[model samples]
Target: MQSPGIPRSREAAPAGWRETADAAIEGGDDPVPSMLTALLRRPATAFSMLAVAVLLGHAAAALLIAQLPRASFGVEAIEDGMIRVTGDDRRYAADAPVAFVGSDGRVRLARVMEDLVPELEPRGSSSEITAIYAERDRIAALLREPGLMLRLPDGRQLPAAVRPGRIETLSSGFWLSFGIALCSSLAGLWALVLRPREWAARMFMLSGLGLALGAITIGALEQVSLATGSRTLFWITHINYLSAYIFGFAIVALFARYPRPLIGKALLAGFAAAQGAIWVMGLLKLDVDMLGIQIFVVLLLALLAVVLAGVQGWLSRYDPALRASFLLIWISLLLSMGLFSIVSLIPQLMGSPDIVPESVSAAAFLLFYLALAVAIARYRLFDLGSWAVNVGLSALVLIAVLAVDLALVLITGGTWTVSLAFLTAAILWLPLRELVLRRAERRRDKRDLLLLRGASEVAFAPRPEQQTVLWSQLLDRQFSPLTIAPVTCDTAAIRADGRILAIPSPLGGTGLVLSYANQGRRLFNSEDRSVATALVALVAEMVDARAAYDRGARAERQRIARDLHDDVGARLMTTLHRGDLETVHADVREAMADMRLIIDGMSDQPRRLSDIVADLRHETVNRLVLARIHAHWPITAIFDDERLVDALQARVLLSVTRELVSNVIRHAGAGTVSIRCALTGNSLLLAVRDDGRGFDVDSDTILGNGLRNTRKRLEELGGSMAVQSGPGGSVIEIGLPLPSREQGMSDRSMAV
Candidate 1:
């Protein structure tokens, strides 16, 4: 049941759970039921259910409003303690007490009826009124005229100040409250659905529930007050206060838990109990003054909670994403509450009518919910620190743009402010912001590059112990871990402390364990893990490569030892047994020279053809002189001195030359030997001719060990050797192709 591409190992899920996880991963089973089960298991499910209930309640309220009978009567005119109204009498009763408007254009409660006596006349001639009246005597005194207009309870206008549209007002308030409640509930449900395990998310769900309840109660209170024409709606007020208490408690809880909880469980529980007590008091309709004091206490506690949360967040070293999310939440809370506070304070300060209504203030809570939702859903939750900075910069730019636009508008008295603001932002602010952001990004990139370079050094480290030390240093620099030690774990994983990361050892045996970050800093993030994974992979490759190289080197050394024992050892033994002291000495000297050449060949330095030719000529002449033979050395360098040859080619060429000279001296009884070196086109040619008794080229006996090894070496170097043997002389010709400049560089790099 394991998924394709996912490895099956002991590190994977346990036996019972593995199959289900694999099925889900492999897309072979329905995962929704399991997911739903998981969601329902969390405490947030209760809040989610509450949200759904709130939504359904709103729907029911809407349906009830639709089924109700419509109001009919409207105010027409006022005259001599009497009011004239117009509407369909069949639908409306004659004596029904309805909402009315007097001369001053204010709504009031009054009885609308058909006149019993027909002598009453309209009084007022002016459309404007001096004042509103609640009593009949005052209303009659003011309504000695009939030119004033009024709106009816059903939202119809009349000539006189008559019945105000109470029904219409109630309908508007109900729908607005219902919409706010529905949205708040949905936001709560969404937070719970997204991250049920998060305590902050649970608190947010409760906050949304509180907001919905508060909106509903407040809206209902407004509707009932309008319908009954009474301000003493004590029961509705109590419910409203209860909802407010719940809302304040939830908001404080959410703030305390957000990003990460700093408050203790006992303290949180105590706070919750106090809020619950306040709610109970409101439910019991306690003394108004006592209720007010409790409500103020709840508000103060919420404010205190917010302040503590802010302090904790500011002091803590959060990862980038958490920092950004916290900043966003802070901004959302501030804007929502700040705007509402401003709206409330402005009217009192200036003694003017309220510019923003209560209904609009209720909708501002949505901002905080929306911000929480975004933070939860985002992929890089801990890396949004840069985003917070950008948000601040953008806000500043916007404010500046607005200020400039206003200034220009006021100065020119024209509609050029918008265009000017756009130009200013495009030409100045945007580019500046981009430059600053790019610089910040470059700093981050530089830090990453430093880690990469350190990893590279570890990869090419000369020893396993050095590699381990370097790797530890790299982790220390990148993550500031407190300690790094070898562990027995075979798989990469996060440790129990949450700050430690365990990476399986690349060198095999004990794995590596990185402890907590230094100074009790923030926990290790995904980005740090990703970088560590890359380092581990690189080190693994290096270890594998080094192992393969050691294996190949051991095999090569064994082959060389076997060859030396079989060929050179036998020759020296035979010479020693025959009591040929001079030949024995010569053989030992040649063996020592060959060993030196082998050592030289192992070096990575590049050799030039001219230098190699000179060394070969010297060795050849010395050997010929030792054999008491005349030597003719006519060598002409046809290639440039800078033309480099690799170690392999130098080794092959030297080996072949030594073999040819030894053959001419020890086997061929040559009196004189001639050597010629020249360059032909892109090839280097070397010919050695000796005036000695030549062997037959076609004879099988003529192919000795020396001749075979010479031919093999030439062939390995991408060259060819030809032997021409006769009675007069024997000639050996070898040709090797020269590599181009680019090829030489490539070969040189490969040698390194």
Candidate 2:
């Protein structure tokens, strides 16, 4: 059993095997690079391709229009095509209408009655000029309103039907219109694709229906301008215009109920019934040419309904997502419809002959469609409706007040004083508003103080002084200077360092355990919980001060122990072992006396070298007398810290001084010795010169006993010793780092 079983060799196993397996099992060690790679893999969308196609189509159309002949008239009608004029509450007509021949002598018609062609006259272009044609009934009816005159290529004002040359240019306008409409349609399609779900399925379907209606409207406006010959196309244009108006109203109603299924279904049913009624009227030939007023009324009702429903839903505690949807939908509905109504009505009211009513309406609707798309794709308006209302009301009030004040001053005839006063009042609104808001907030906060009284709670336990007990459990919460939480609970007795008290709370209640220390005293308070907080700060200060004190004390003790071991203790021990009673008695007494003095000085404040130089000199002289050697020591660089300089850093200086005096007595047999101390740069230099029987400087046989040990002690003091011995005498020089006493006393130290 004693013979150990052959020990298993640990080196037989492979190295780093566990580490390799760990690395293999771990995945996704580098996260940032992998995320960047995933982002780079995302694909582009279809809208990019559609944009390219629209741009190319525009470029081709522009090229085609540039090649068309300039100022080429495209419409000519005369004679039987009678022109009727209606203006200033009356209609005018020309009987026995005669066709006006052109410069090339072509006569198109002769009429029994001409409505307004007699009002036109030609200059410098001659023709037979007399012809007749019967008036077309429908053309006469539509041309009945000639409130405005037209200018021809020859700069002549004429009736609507009687033109000396071609009256319309379709080539350039058609090419331009094609480019604009194509690009607009492409953009609209892209918008339609962009997250249309939020607008209720019915809204998206209505948008589709609006697009078809818009195309028909464009065709109707084009037909009226071109004066095409087809009767069917003429009447069909009017019906399409009515459809466009009705569909526009339906789109608004559907968008108002966006994201709600039941509202959308109800709206769709209403829209269908309205459309059927309008179609029936059109079929019966009621001639409904303008439906803008009817559509406007419908939209106004829908907006009012949306606002009321939104307020009711908010009061009923609807989900946050649904509430936000309703808010943004209402905002878009109000703003877009309001802008469209105002802008579209402007052209009709101004009666601008060049501006197209349908085109302006379409542009406004385009912007609305884009806004709707954004609202559906992004749940954008957390506060959009409120923000709009607040901003709008503020602007309106400020403008009205300022306008009234300015107008009153102006009407009363003003100087700069009145103008300046109104301007200052308007400019001061922002800061005045801010001040008022802050005051109101402060008042509200004060009123609710009772409710907030128990809102903050503080936890209490032992502070950091007792590491054996955990820190105050409530201290886990951060401390704020202005607000405090006070918590109170009984804690378990302190444990050893790092030991935790797992105190459980009762039933559903929460409780805390704290770190504690007992030095025959209780450290916590029964009242204010801040006692623990103050205790923590006090303990921290004590810890730093105690650490510094212990460090200095340890260093001083080690120095004293080393001195006794190498000096007095060694000397006494040497004398006792020699079997000389007289020498042993004297040496032991000296050692005991020196030990007592050292013990007494240990509690005293440190002293400087200059203060203790006289004592050192007397002790050195007595020792030298015992050794039968003469000695002299003169301190030249006197300092205020005598004990620090002579007792601490002067250890090397004193040792060198003693060794030099002893060697002169033992080996050199010198009669006299001189020791001098001085400062050089950051160092302390000492010179020990002696007159004795000196030996060869370089001879190995001349090496003295204990010389190596003396030189080593000098070097340990961060100094070097040089010895020169010849036939005449020997000199020993020692240099040391400046003492700490010297450092503290320096004038530059005050700046630190």
Candidate 3:
């Protein structure tokens, strides 16, 4: 089962699963506590190890920087090419270029510019820094010398010697940069661990790796006072620019295909080639904008791509869960990418000071990674479709557009060219957003109608077994859970943070468990639970109504069958044994009369209890006389004689009394029989007393078929029959329930 906080795995193929897809009540374990996190390994070993390795990599970067000669010029670049040398121990000239004489007799003139410290100074530029690149090889070879002659602005020349830098010498800024980079890498690995096959996750991880590489390499160069090596400096600059372009490419590719696929892998490859070429041009120093304008433009496209992706994802509401997942992805991408571009790239483009440190700006990428991690953990987990869409994601995107446009104009002298791009969106995007929401609402209504139709199919299925089948089918079609297992839950519930859902039968039986909603593409939420609850309730009501109808029909048929065996069958059997022709003829007539009563009893019409009792008394007396035994029943002794009884109850009452008389004649051989009737509580009480030779009533006495049939008739009316026998006589007691009469009926009943 797909559980929350874990990636969903492939569903195990159940035997004959295609026949029904998912079967209810087949016991299946909940897959909440998952072990298959990544590449068949646990998080501790796979993803955590990546973080540990990045930790070690940070130490290695620090160690490499420590190996560079510590110049300690005591002159820090305060701003664009401006140096501030404080205190007498400072070695560099305050207002003039410092000259260095290497062991190879090369005395190079120093010309300081913002290009030399573009990364260190907030407003530094690399425009004038190109000269050092051509001479980097010779200077790198000379740094190996033991000492060099230094000319300071103070006109004092001293021999400069190198001391090996310690770990303590590394600035806090360097640590912060590596730390941010490490965090970004870990975030990507975390997402990849959860969903290794997802392109969105893979691209997000790729972006993190790019961000990490760029941050660390730029940090190492910015920290270095003297060159590390001829090749090393070249490699560091190349890695920095390459990482920037890679980060941009990954972000753009991620936006193009995530939340919904706008482009395929082939187009993604094209994006890679384009971005890679831009990085190549930057490395070759082909133009003035190579390092700054071209790369920053790519970043701008990446941001625009994500915004457009988010817009497209929101508008295409076909997959509710996917749209929901895209909500987080879009908002986070907008805020993180938007903020970083504004504070870092725009300033560099506009020749303005950085608003925040580069490392801190890089920390904004962490939010992007965090959003991806959260989107991975949460998406493929369905939330309420419209709720996910309407949670201000579109507004945030629109706001980001305006904010970026405004920031660009405000930072870069407020140009109309930049402002024009966002002008149309700022005006029309909100209405377009509302239109999409309206479409989503219409779809939701249609979804509800479909559920109603499905419920009818489930509730009115001709057979109980078929009803169950249809029920399972209905749920499977609605939610499309990968696994629907058996659960002992009685009420509708969502478990494992919407990973598993329990849907109870309205008839109050064990329910089915649904895991990994949308075929494990999403988790279950309250919206799902509410949908399940509402649908099941409709099905349960119809099911209960149909069941009650079938139960009544079945019970009536059984009642008719029982009455036939006890009344008509018993009378005809008794007459066949009788040798006298007149007695046989009289018995056959009585049987026909009883059959008419049974037929009349099928109607819902009520009869007077007083008249039913009088007829019953007369029939019992005649039977006793026919058997040559005295019978007694007082006409007025029956109390509550005005009460009415339904036709079924009246029919049961007469047939049961007659069966008692038959048992006495055929088995008791009684001389005197007396009948009594009354109402007690909600029941009608009847007793037959016979004065005869007593028979065993308590010692496992077996009743004749006639007597057994009498008890069965009583049971059909929800009544009971009990026998008490002693030396004097045998007494048979019967109690049949008196259902409440229909409201507003007159309290009048006619006697016979």
lDDT of 3 by residue, 510-607 (tens): 67888767876666777788888898779888888888998989988987886777678878888889999977877887798789878888886787
Task: Evaluate model 2: give its TM-score.
Answer: 0.37
Candidate 3 off by > 4 Å: 1-40, 43-45, 48-121, 124-183, 191-206, 212-246, 249-344, 352-396, 399-439, 458-552, 569-655, 662-671, 676-686, 692-703, 712-729, 734-752
Ranked by TM-score, the better of candidates 2 and 3 is 3
- For candidate 3, the per-residue lDDT at 664 reads 77
Error of 1 at 145 (Å): 26
* lDDT (CA) per prediction: 0.60, 0.45, 0.67
Model 2 off-target regions past 4 Å? 1-44, 49-101, 104-253, 263-270, 273-318, 346-369, 379-752
- Among all windows of 10 consecutive residues in model 2, the one with the lowest summed lDDT is 120-129
TM-score of each: 0.49, 0.37, 0.49
Candidate 1, residue 749: the lDDT equals 30
lDDT of 1 at 548: 90
Candidate 2, 67-185: lDDT as tens digits: 32221112322323433322322222334333423334443333323332321111111121111111223333333333323333233434444221122433333433443355444
